[model samples]
Target: MEFRQVSDLNFNISRVTLGTWAIGGWMWGGSDDQLAVGTVIEALEKGITTIDTAPVYGFGKSEKLVGQALQEFGNRDEIQLATKFGLEWDDEGNVQRNSTRERILKEVDDSLRRLQTDYIDIYQVHWPDLDTDFSETAETLQELLDSGKIRAIGVSNFSPEQMDEFQQTAPIHVCQPPYNLFERGIEKDVIPYCKENGITLLTYGALCRGLLSGKMSKDRTFNKGDMRRDADPKFQGETFDKHLEAVEKLKEYADKNFDKKVIHLAVRWILDKGIDSAIWGARKPEQVTFDNAFGWKFSHKQVKGVEEIVETIVEDPVSPAFMAPPE
Candidate 1:
C-alpha cells in the first residue's frame, strides 16, 4: 500500500484507508465480526496504517470490533485510527443529526471506551448539524484537541458553505466526501476549496457503492436490509442503467489500455485525481487485499482516457431535494 502525507496534520496516511462501515453491520448486506477483525489485521500486515470508522456504525459495535482487532495486534501506535460522531441513532433505527456540545462530549467518551484507545488520531464529525451552531461544535472539538483526546479534526459529508463555517472557528485537517468517476459534484466546489486551503481530501464511495466494479448485473436485486438497495440513487432503476452504460465504457478502456479488471482501473482513475486517500468499505479480508492491489498508479494516457470517458456521462450530484435519509 502507498502512503501520502497530509501536510496539515503531518500524518502519513495510507493511500487506501480501510473503511469499517460494512463491518459495522448496520447498512451493508453481509457482515462478519471475525472477518472484520481479520481484515484489519490483514491490512496492517500489508502496511495499511489507516482505519476509518464511526460511532453510529453498528451503534458502536464497529468501534468495539476495531478495538479488539487492535488489541490482538498490540501495536496501536503503528496505525492511524479515525472515528466519527454527530449522528444519533434512536430506538426506531432512525438517525437524528445533533452536534451539540453535550452530545459530542458523550459520544466521544463512548467511542474512546469502545475503541480501547486513549486518544484518537483523527476525530471527525460524521456530518454537519444545521440545527446547532457550528461554533458550538468547533469549540467542543477544540477543547478535545486541547485536552489531548484527539490529534486532528475533520468533517464528513459537509457542503462547501458548512466547511467554511467550521474552518472559520477551527482549523480542519481533513474533509471526507463522496467522490468517484460517477459522482463528480465535489469538483464544482469542495475539491477546489480543499486544494486551495491545504486540507486533505479523504474520499469515500470511490466505487459508487460497487457500481464501478462491473459486478452488478442488470437483474441484480439487493437483499431487503441492504442500505444501497433503498438509498443509493445509482442503484435505482433508470439511474442504474445509465451508470451501467458508463461502466461498460470504462471496462472497454480498462481492457484495451491496462489489461486489468475494471475495478482496478476505476480505483486508479480516482487516485490520479490527486485525492490524498481513498477509504474502501470492505467486509472481508479478501476484499481488502483486492482493493490494496487495485493499482494506484496510472499512465498519462490511461488518466486522460478516464477523464474523457467520465466527462461524457457524468451528471451533477443529485440535488439536496433528492437526498435520502442517512443510514
Candidate 2:
C-alpha cells in the first residue's frame, strides 16, 4: 500500500505493482477472465494502483482483461498502467525479440486499443533486441513520449551498458529487472546503476515464482504447461529442496523477529534494498495481499542476518535465467 515517486515524471507508483504475466495465461498454464478482473479490482482496493503487463502476455489477452477491469473500476485516472513492447509471438506461441521502429509504432497503438487508454502511464521495452540499434529504439520511444502516447519510458532485463546506450538517445525514467531474495544478480550492477542514475527500479519476480510464498510444500506439483516446470531451474530437484529449506528458515526468522511471513520478508527485502517498487505476480483475487508487506522496515543487520541464513541453506542458488528471451 506504500507509494514511491519517480523523479523524472513525478509518478507515485505503489510499492506492489500488480503483475499480469500469469493472468495472460501464456506460460502459467491458463487464466480465468472473471478471476483476472477480480484480481485487478482486489489489488486496487488494497491500494495497489499500478498494473504491469505486456503485449506478449497472452498476446494481448492480459491487456484486454486489464482494460475491462479498468472500465469496471470506473476511474481510469487512479491507476498507473505500465506495459511493455519489443517481443512478438507466432501462431504457435514462439517468442522473439523485435524492437525495430516499425514494431514499436505498431505495438503502441495495439496496446492502446487493448488497454482502452489513449496514453500509457509508463511504456517499457520487454527485452533488449540485439538486432535493432539501441539509438533507433530510443528515438522511437522518445517520439512516443513527445507525442503523448506514453508518459514515461523504461526498459526491462537490460544491463548497465545497454541502459547507457539507451539513455544516450532517450531519457529512461525506470528500469525493470528480475530480482528477489533468491536472485541477487542485479545487486552486482543494475541496482547501483539505477540508484545513481535517478531511474526508479521496478523489480519483478518478488515471489520467485511462488517459492517465497511460504505455502509451497515439498510434495507440491506444477501444471504440465507451467513455466516453473521447465523454464525455471530453481524448481528442479536438489535446488528446489534447498530453496524450500531456505524459505522455511526465512519464515521462522520473519515470524520470530517481525511477526511476518516469508513472502512479506521477500518483498520487504527488495524495498529495503532501495527498489522503488516490486511487481507481485498473481492470478487470483485473494492472492493480491499488499497490506502485510508495506510499512515494515528492515535493519541493515537484519538484512545481513537473512542473507547469512540463506547462504547456509542455498549454497548453489540459481537465477531465473530461463525466463530471458532468446538471443
Candidate 3:
C-alpha cells in the first residue's frame, strides 16, 4: 500500500512492484495464463500498481498477459508500467544483451503493442551490452524520452562505472539491481552510488528464488526449466542446506520479534535499508500477499540478529550472478 516517487517521473509507484519474470513462464517452469492474469489484478487490488516486466520474459508472453490484465482492469492512467529492452532471443530461447540503437528502436514499439500502452512509466535496459557504446544507447533512450514514449530511463545489473558512462548522455532516474537478504553485493557500491546521485533503486529477487519464502523443503524438486535446478549454485549441494537453515532461523526470528513470517522480514529489511522499492515475484494470485511486511520498523538490534543468523549459518553463500545470461 506504500508508494514512492522516482523523482524524475510525474507519478508515484507502489513500494512493492509486481515482478512478472516467473509469470512469463520461460524460466520458472510454465505458468497458467489464467493465473498470470489474475496475479496482476490481485496485485493491483492489493495496492501494488507498479508492474515490472521485460521483453525477454517468455519472449513477450509476460507483457502480453500484462496487457490483457490492464484491459481487464480498465484504468491505464492509474497504473505505472515498467518494462525493459536491450535483450534479444532466438528460436531456441537463448538471450543476448543487445543495447544497440536499432534493437531498442524496434523493441520499444513491440513493447508498446504488447502492453497496449502509448508510453511506458519507466523504461530500462535489461542489461549492459559491452559491445554497444553507452552514449549510443543513452542517446537512443533520450530520443524516446523526448518523444514521450518513455517517462524515465533505467539500467539493470550495471556497475557504478557503467552507470557513470551511461549518465554522460542521459539521466538515469532509476536503477534496478539484484538485492535481498542473500545477495548483498550491491551494498558495497550500487546502493551508495544510487543514494549519492538521487537515483531510485528498485531491487529484484527479494525472495531469492523462493528460498526465503519459507515454503521450500529439503526434498522439494524443481522443473527442468527452473533456474534453481541448475543455473543457481545455491540450489545445489550443501549451500542449499545452509540457506535453508538460515531461512528457518530467520522465520523464528521474525515470529519471535514481530509475529511475522520470514518473507515479510525479508521485504521490510530491504525497505528499511532506504531502497525505493522491492520487486516481489509471484505467478499465483495468493502468493502476492505482503501486508505483514508493512506498518512495522526493524530496530538496529533486530537487524543485527537477522544478520547474525545469516552469517552464522550460510558460510558458503553464493551470489546471484549464476542466473545471469551469457552476454
Candidate 4:
C-alpha cells in the first residue's frame, strides 16, 4: 500500500482507493449491507485507507454503509474519507447537475451526516454544472475549507478549461477522472493538466466496471436494474465482444509475462501511466484482494506491446459517454 501526498492535505492517501459506487447498488442492480460492510473491512485490513464515494451513489446508501463500517472499525482519523456532491436526484432517481452555492452548502451538511464524519478528507464536485457559474461553486467550496467542513476540494469529470475557470476562485487539490485500460479518454487533457498543476489524480473504474476484471464472459447476463444492462455501451453487442477480445489478450499477456491476472494488469496500467491513485470497485470481501495489484509494474516496452494488443483486438472501442450527468 504505497501512499502519495496530495497538495495541502494532512494524510498520504493510499495508491489504491476503495470505490463504493458498486456497493451503492444504484446502477449495478442491488447490494447487501452485510456484504458491503465486510468489503470495506477487508479493504482497511488490506491497507486501503482512502474510500471514494458520492452522494448520488445509491442516493446516500453507500455513504451510510461506509459510515457504519468505519464506526465498527473505530478508526476515523486513520482513514481518509473522500466523497462528492452537486449531483442531485429525486425519489424517482432522476439526476441532474446542481452546484449552486446553496446546493453546495446544503450538500456538505448532508454528506457529513451520511458519512458520519465532521470534516471530509476531500470533497469534490461530482460533475460540472453548466447552468451554474464556476465561481459560485468554487467560492462555496472555499467557504467550506475555511470553516473546516472539508479539508480539501476536488473535481470530477472536469476538463482542463473548466478546472482553469474554477481555480480562479478556489484551490483544487485533486481531480477524479474515469480511467481504466479501456477508458483512456482523460489521458489527452485531464491527466496532463493535473500533472502540470500538481493536482493529484485519483482515477476511478480501474477495471472498466468489471470488464477488465477477467471475470466477464460472453454469456454472462446482467440483472434488469444493472447499469451495464443498458447504460454502458461497452456491454452492448459488438462493442462488448471487441472489449472482451482485448481483455482476453491482455489476460493472456499478464499471465504469460508476470503470472498476474488481467485485473492486476488493469490496475498497474493506471498507476504506470502516472496516476496518483486508482479506485478499485468491490462489493465483496474476497473482491478486495490487493496483493495482486501491487509490488509490480509493466515495463515501457511491455506497455507499448499491451497497447498494440489492444489496438489489434479492439476494433471499435467505445467511450463511457453514457455515464455523464445531464447538462
TM-score, one value per model: 0.92, 0.98, 0.99, 0.98
Q: Ten consecutive residues with minimal summed lDDT in candidate 3?
A: 316-325
Candidate 3 lDDT over 1-327, as tens digits, reads: 788999666778888999999999998988999999999999998888899999999999999999999999978999999999999989999888899999999999999999999999899999999999999999999999999999999999999999999999999999999998988999999999999998999999999999989999889899988888958888887888889989999999999999999999999999988889999999999998877789999999988888888988888668888767787
Please give the clash total of every predicted structure, in order: 0, 0, 0, 0
Task: Give the TM-score (vs. native) of candidate 1.
Answer: 0.92
User: Comparing candidate 2 with candidate 3, which one achieves the higher lDDT?
Assistant: 3
**Residue pairs of candidate 4 with colliding backbone atoms:** none
TM-score of 2: 0.98
Ranking by lDDT: 3, 2, 4, 1
lDDT of 1 by residue, 22-70 (tens): 7888867667899999988888887779999998788888999999999
Residue 123 of model 1: what lDDT?
A: 89
lDDT of 2 at 195: 86
* Per-model CA lDDT versus the true structure: 0.82, 0.91, 0.92, 0.91
Misplaced by over 4 Å in model 3 are: none
Query: After aligning candidate 2 to the native by TM-score, how far in Å is the CA of 66 from where it should be?
Result: 0.7
